[model samples]
Target: MQDRPTPGQHWPITTWQGWQHFATTPPPTAPQPGEPPRSTEERLAYHSAFVTVRTPAINTLATQVRTLMLLGRHQQTTARPSLIVTGPAAAGKTTALLEVGRTCHLAHTRKHPAPPGLAHQQVPVAYLLVPPGATAKTLATQFARYLGIPTTTRMTQTQITQAVCHTYTTAGVRLVLIDEIHRLNPRTTTGAEAAGLLKDLTERIKATFVYTGIDVAATPLFTGAAPNSPAAPASSPAAPSPPATARPDPSPTSSPTWRTPSTSPTTHPTHSPATPPTSTNAPPAASEASPASSAKQPSPPSATAPNASPRKHSKPSSSTTSPKKQAAPAPANRPKRHDADVKKSADTPNDEDFAALYDRAWDILIFARAGYLDDVSAHYDEVLHEIAQRTEHTGSLGKTDIAALVVWKRLTAQTRWATDLMSLPDTHVRAVTEQAVTAVRDTTLPRSEAARTGRGIIAELPGLRTGDALASAVLTAAAPQRMAVYDRRVQHALDTLGLTLTPAPGRYGRYLQLLDDLLSHGAARADGWSARDIDTALYQMGANPHPAGT
Candidate 1:
């Protein structure tokens, strides 16, 4: 057995090539007697850390999305078609969009000359998350918020919409990415309303829409059908037929049977003794008689002569062998001829059915298909393993400390809160850290009591607001098993499971209850994993559920 790494000790960075290698390298087996087993809290803490890996699917999808944005920028009269990029939780849909956002930002900054009369640089891409159970007004406000435009509760829906359009137009936004689109429950009236709002936005604004969510293909917004309509079929078209000339004839023997060409001595008249055989050692023979005399002389029995004495002459004449020799080469050359014919037939384009077979167009790019999860899960598991390895030497850190770090990382990973948290004063950080510890401790209380306590603690965080992502992150970190972060990714995961979190009165409470029920009654709890593990798993499932055999 090898010596195990000490907990909380920082490993030399030069020893590892990449996070992927660090994650996949197996750790030492269980320690000997007197040594302690790894704690569950440490495992949970490592699993909850934020990491980003760009898989092949993410890169291909990002390239396609960038191409669409470029096309939208060039279009003058045409209404650019909306793009839908959806997958299971943790599929990295948001990460891909963020990459696109970075590209657009870089392009904007690199422009040599500012557009005439523009006070600020034009933003080519506007990326925003769709609020949970978002209404038109809520969505408009979110857009405005992304644009850095002041939004207030006092503003009417129409005013917010107008402001959003005006700001995006002025910024020269060519593309808008609306993430967590699965939250728009098509089963309710709000779903249709949200779809209508998006359609209106595209018609009025110059930007093309890129919507990302979980199993978005199942939703009416992408399927282009009513919620109640028959489900759209899912399949790729059949393989195309070979061209007419390439098609085999109906006759059984149209294609010749494969066989080795004959190399027998009897087939060569000159080589056979009975068929006027020529000797290899002898000099060439010259005809001595004139052509007239040769023709008049009785031609020695032709090799094809049927009545020739079989006892004396056993082999056939050149006349009988010539035709077979010519036919032998035909079979050898047949395939090449057939292929050329097929090519010619394909180029002719005489068949209407063949043209029609390829006329279909694709509007939705469904990322959440079978086998997607396997790729994403392997990538995520590798990341978690790497974190566990790094933190192995830090065993002295208490569960609360690990949990607080997890909360901090997750909260700050959000685009809106990242900068604010980084610039926050030390006193505010300490308060937030204390609140996280308390929140985790309070999970032992009953549901109602815990909710009340959790809400109070969340309200105390310096920069956090009630029902926002930061507050939810703190609460989720404290009691991960019982509470879940109600962010877009979580919502999309729930939607993929055919579940909905209604944003009615007491929406946060209802959301918590829904997650609790899911853990208790849904497949999520079957593995006996902790709430935090389940949350992470579901987020991955929503982001990019691995398909079969991935």
Candidate 2:
């Protein structure tokens, strides 16, 4: 345990020693007014590390984590309450989480000095990222990796989990910090199980957990509330950045490195997205951010130092990199599923709604067909099954197949969509739909990301450009088992059931996650269920929701 990484070697932050270094190491010093980096390497190094901005939001988070840690320490049998920090991407959620971890690590070391030779062995904190398409096994392995536990390919998930819990406990880890919590889509089977695993760990380990992500409150991720263990968790919003302000600099700018700290705040405190009563499932829109560092470069360079002496040409050398960096920040938006907090909160669902539905998820699956428009709806499974076969064999759908789904989806939709898709030339529709189909079925991407990519590509087709109903249908048709259909009806049912599935972009992906969650809760009752099955149930729930007989 006393062993440390070789100097300058890439230390995995997931490991205990790596985290120990991060928690103890200080951020690089910013260039002073008179001291700018002289070379390209210096500029990159300066831009690489995120600036630590101590705003009111991060300070509050620190205090909350500390309080919860102390409270969890005394709890011998109960699951401790945890904290969730949600905000926009690039809005400092990651930065704040790290700062809080650093504070916790140093504070613990000062308060609980190891006695004699046991100094380095008393690990106090652990950190991990919720991976893209995180599974229970992957998550458990991450924990093992953080603690340097040896895991073989032969190890079962249960065995790995048992080892991790035992090791973390033995290490005296009191605080567990997980970043990118938004990646865990509780609606997906794997996401739901991963979420369940986390909840289980909270109960089993005597540690306080702090989760940070983009707008986690607004998505089904908030449905993280479980009855067996812990108290309810609390959330803190990220620091509000002021409007973007810029300063004039005569010096040549670095494409990637920092400019003077822009006086104007580029970001504001992102308010939690509120679900309107009418459209509870309108998920938040989001995009990925560049590196977390805040280095703002100066303006682009002038041509040949523009009418100046030849020697002055070198003065503005930093200008060349400016355009690339400036253009790079162009659209670092948030994800459609990067919602704010727990399912029970926000405008999506109420506790009563969940109590009524989550427990009887099986009833929804088995009985939804009876009340549903069976005459029309039954054709969906048959037709989709055939279409799915085609997609499986060909890797993309043809124009006729695409058109059939558009017609069927619109026909079943409560709100009939009028579109000119039928009139479009087969070649045009075929090209766009195929591109979308391929992106959605991409094996490499997380299903959520794949849905987003596919949606953007498919929206070029008629009718799909405006609403997701047709696009979702096509994507689901592309991979029936892997994807799910979404429309206002499904949204209505989810809202009624106290679940959140917004119509924000990339919603098709989120819809699958929502279905996965039901299947997860359904357990054995939902055996052999597909995301498509959940959509049918949602249709029924939205059509008529209430007590069984009444």
Candidate 3:
């Protein structure tokens, strides 16, 4: 009898009941790849019609809000900075807001877990669309609706506000999502009263307020703030969305990705020399150049993988090469399926300035990803992030734990692999995923070998056999600091930058290797950068190959 949330309800979140349903009901059995057509017509129709496309903007927005949640959790006072999401209708403003709310929902559940038997009717997130002809009392009633608090026609706005605020506080609501904000005209007496009520609720309930409306920045929403209140950040940039997209604000520190930096050819695969050699004088940093089996070479070590060789090798043959540059040599021990990865590292720039070859394309990516570098990079760094730190990755693993990780991977990648994920029995899936994640979490394993060990195990699942994209995301979610994400876009960006990443079987490990080389050049956390940040940068570069800046 329980209802599940549709993808529509939460491109931006879930209803309280929707969230409860997921908490209570176990997932249904997913069909195997080779299984015959035993599912009903309704199921087939549902599968075909329910499509979930990944949206980078939503990921960015979700990451931003999650970061904000971390900020609020540590605060000593109740007042938190409110966010306003305004853009043209159909631009996914509501979707972004809801997604953030859902993120908070999951994060809260993860933090405070309770089984169905012990679970209470606690509300951590509330989503409300500004009602048509909204007024102070009407808006207050909307708040009451979510909590199922009865409001009679005789109830005064003050009484409603007191009841709503007290209930939300008791329910432990942390996120208050308000959409269709443009419908409220602050200039009107009623609109002003509604606005005041909103301010009062935000102050009294101890929750972060997020407002979404159409073209609200230029509307009265911006100017209507009481002179004494902290006005919504003058221009709270709208998060990105695929449909009716909203533009993200530009990053101030974002510079030309095309600026070619010099790198040493002979440095270790794990890291390049602080000041790279002018040329490839020494042997190409034995990046997959010398297969571990092909020669008596010791496995190289990266910061993350102290015992294993880095997987990716970027030997710039020519910084002058126009669009579409070469990738670094592949690891020597890669599967025999491909040979390009094993090629010797070229005697060229270890580092090619992003601008030198793909300035325009990379510049555009920088414009997008750079704006959220701090938030997105820190996406997994705290309470709201994806991966737990090395210390907290302990305890027994279960199907739900694995399912949670799979969900995290889907959210971060924004892909619709739910069907693929459902292929294996939940228990079997958990067993395989646990092994893979455990490999990466091993503090003693060389970072490179840990990645290889982990990637190998996860690849056993149905959808992961062919590509490293999803597998890499899973691994990164396992150890956010030690691993970077890889996908076609990251690959394309690398190749376009003239960096190398062959399509060989061991590409996942090599990709991390490449990231280490890049990170090494900048020095370990010198600029507070990590494998994830570099991965995001490269993803940006590959995502938009032909940017306007070019």
Candidate 4:
């Protein structure tokens, strides 16, 4: 055999077996260099990310998303934590929420984007926006979908709650987001009542919820908790023992503020034979008993208490029970006039009452945009002038007549005025009507409807689209003429600011979707953003009609 090679040397093969080994043996290889780890963007690209927003906030929102994703990982075996991004109009709450859904690896998220701009996230990390003209059922349908609950054609609140709990529990969701909460209130009683039902469903569900609204007051049900509160300190300082005094008088404004008694205290009889000696002393005048006392009166032992010991209490019999038991206390009556309701009612619009106001303002915007504020007939200007004077004196279009007058003046003005009136409270709408007419004395009229509609197009603005009913009134007043509704100003503002490149639309739904997508894109770039930022930016975009330097 050939001399054997050394231990460290390559072996010499001469035999058939050695040749076989040599033929099959692997080569001595050089070390391979390691490739760099993939980044979030790379991984996301591999997954085919397609968000389209380009705002700077997106990067921040992306960071939040990573944190949330990490948090979600820990939550995979438990309830997921809820994330709510609330802010005023145009704040990117909805968009940021969508970014979470798009970038996060949570099971899946239900996205419900609403019209006229309201976006929210809900249980199981589902994102939803309360419909523009939301009613209780409209909201319920969305809730049911997010929770994975089913509802019948005519499901009741009880049914909705059961479905919500069952679905949320089954889906392993821990959070729910409600957006554009302020639009919940409606002009009609039916609308208001429906809103109340939605409010109740939210309270009943156990999922952690985040709600977005224009103002803090608009969402009293949610953020009502003390800021940075702990878990109720194990137990709240025992609800202070109510002091003895007359029952609190019913409040006149307690229409929708009914406090449902989840577990009513057992009602005591008017008087008790087994009454403790402590309470048996001369009955204090009803006026003297604190309101708490009246609400908690014990029944006479002989009539209502079957558990009373025979020695200490007389037995109650069927005969002792009156044909009609005294009426149980009605639940705390609903708040007749919560500030929201008061504001809504006071702001409600009516027909011809505000007709003239609309007419005059319409005329003004038309004239101003068309560059013809000096050719209108003197009488037309005078009518607007008079209506403006009346609105200023009244301070608000609370009455139908006043709204009609305002509408009339608005329609006849030389420049477009509808967009300006949208954000103002009724009081401001009235005052502004006064100022607009005073500002333009001899505005020219558009020669024809076609010319007028084409000459002045108001950019869609947030908070401007009244419901179908209100829109109908204004559109009708302008007559067979088609004027683009000022319903998506925020979107237009974003586009104008170069924050977004998407073209704004006249319809409310389109604009809402666009904004949601943009915000989501922005949010995906980083941590979540404050609603104030979104709102402030949009407001600033619109505050200057000429786009801030034009």
Top of the candidates by lDDT: 2
lDDT ranking, high to low = 2, 3, 1, 4
Per-residue lDDT over 315-379 for candidate 3, one digit per residue giving the tens place of the 0 to 100 score? 31211111223232222221221223222222223525421333333343334333222122111
lDDT, candidate 4, at 210? 41
Q: What's the residue-level lDDT of 365 in candidate 4? A: 23
lDDT of 1 at 512: 56
Judged by lDDT relative to the true structure, which candidate is superior, 3 or 4?
A: 3
All candidates' lDDT scores?
Answer: 0.41, 0.55, 0.49, 0.32
Q: In model 1, which regions exceed 4 Å deviation?
A: 1-59, 74-78, 112-120, 227-550
Order of candidate numbers by TM-score, starting with the best: 2, 3, 1, 4
**Any idea what lDDT model 3 has?**
0.49
Listed in order, each prediction's TM-score against the native is 0.33, 0.46, 0.39, 0.26
lDDT tens digits by residue: candidate 4, 1-550: 2222345655322221232233233333322479567778766554452233423333444444344334444432222222223344444444444443434323332233323444223223444566775544556666675433656654554566567666665655444545665454322222333444443433344444444445423232222221101101111101101112222235655321111111111222222222111110011122344422222222222221111111111221111101111111121222222222222322443433233332332232222211111111112222222332333454322224334533432322232444454434755544433332232221253112222232122112211232221232222223211122221333334334333323223232232233333233342221222221232223223322221111
At residue 223, what lDDT does model 3 achieve? 43
lDDT (Cα, 0-100) at 90 in candidate 4: 46
Model 1 compared with the native: what TM-score? 0.33
Count of clashing residue pairs in every prediction: 33, 35, 29, 111
Question: Candidate 4 — which residues are off by over 4 angstroms?
Answer: 1-84, 102-123, 186-204, 213-550
- Write the residue-wise lDDT of candidate 2 on 1-550 in tens digits: 7446678776778888788778777767656888754688877776666556555434555765776676557766434546655555655556666778888888989988767766466688899998886766688889889988998755666788789889888888888888887777544334544665675576567787777777665554554221101111211111111111122233455222111111112232333122101000101112221222221211111231111111111111111000011110111222223233322122444455443455554554455532232212111243454566567666676667865664454343222333366667777776776787788778798666687788888777656776666677788877665677776666655665556565565566666555655655666656545676567556655543221110
Model 2 / residue 307 / CA error / Å:
71
lDDT, candidate 2, at 533: 54
